[model samples]
Target: MQAQSLSYYEILHLPPPPHTTPTISEIRKAYHSALLEHHPDKSILTANDSSTPTVDEIVEAYNILSTSSLKVLYDQQLESVQQSKKIEEARFKRLIAQADSIDLDDFQTATSCVQHSKDIFAESSSITLSTGYARESCHGYPEDTCNLQQIWFRNCRCGKDDAYLVTESMLEHAFLESDNAQSDDRQILVQCSRCSTWIRVLFSLAE
Candidate 1:
């Protein structure tokens, strides 16, 4: 039988022991009861040519759990499965939390929604890139359109004037929609050649 079909504990309708294994007496009791209840010859349904989890099937589960080495292996497999499930759940929750107040079920606006999972470690503490970096493409504008060069800086904020906006010199991934996406939106700076608007996408969480 497939390992997934029934956890040894589930076959006997028993809970996992506190220490990750059942006692020998407990295993014996459950196995005996299960065999008595589901014995093919004695069970009415099976006597009438019906099929169900035979007593042997129960025994198969019992043997695995009752044996010391097999139980250890089964416990490891179970732990791995449980761990994987937890990680997946955590990842989904993280994605949902970053959804920019947008509904995850909304597949229509999913493409437009930009969710930022702010990592303090990833954030730059200070401006490392030198100012006046030229950019050919703005995030919102078409490709090769943002011709504004010479990104300047201020006290705490950056530039967003009519002609050109000074990038923070640390603003990375101003256009990336998702962290799992194909392209890396982490770049120095971007500005629109038409509107002279600088593309700085800082999520509320990152702020």
Candidate 2:
């Protein structure tokens, strides 16, 4: 099975920590049960089948949990991982909610086809044009001012480096589409060139 994706507690069928920490006895019992159920010699399943984890995986899980120090460290790491996942989920939900709230009629009338926002989206600040660290590629920028204008790039969560791009003309187009009198607070939605994920590129058009 894809036991690598699962935590040690999950591998042993024991309760994960913080919410419900399994005792040493419970870990031991689960470990033995897994060995009995999945041991290569004891298992009747075909070699090609990946229904159960290998004997090595079970032993690795058991070794970590059986040790008090390692279990504590693993619990902390697991909690951090779970917290990050929750945060990402919340951000994704907010993005979805914002998308649902948009008036399709108004969006259709906008000059730029890309989505615009009056408020900043999550992670918007993380990939700022002011950073100057990201690669600058002017290839697809406005043809007339291509030399002076270049697209800024940021790494995407999909592991693609410099996948998210924001161009000077794109920001200008997004700003022109805004109906708001205040020009200091505006953002444009930019999708990763390599992935389907979208990120907001915050900027000000005010001179």
- The local distance difference test score of each candidate is 0.48, 0.62
Candidate 1, 104-184: lDDT as tens digits: 122111111111111211343331223112131123444344333223322212332222223322233343434534544
The list of candidate 1 runs beyond 4 A from truth reads 2-4, 17-20, 45-52, 99-207
Q: Against the true structure, whose lDDT is highest? A: 2
In the range 65-145, model 2's lDDT, one tens digit per residue, is 999998888888988999999999999777744432211122211111122211122225343333322223222334353
Clashing pairs in 2: none
TM-score, one value per model: 0.41, 0.48
- The count of residue-pair clashes in candidate 1 stands at 2
Q: Cα lDDT of model 2 overall?
A: 0.62
RMSD of 1: 17.4
Q: In model 2, which regions exceed 4 Å deviation?
A: 1-4, 100-207
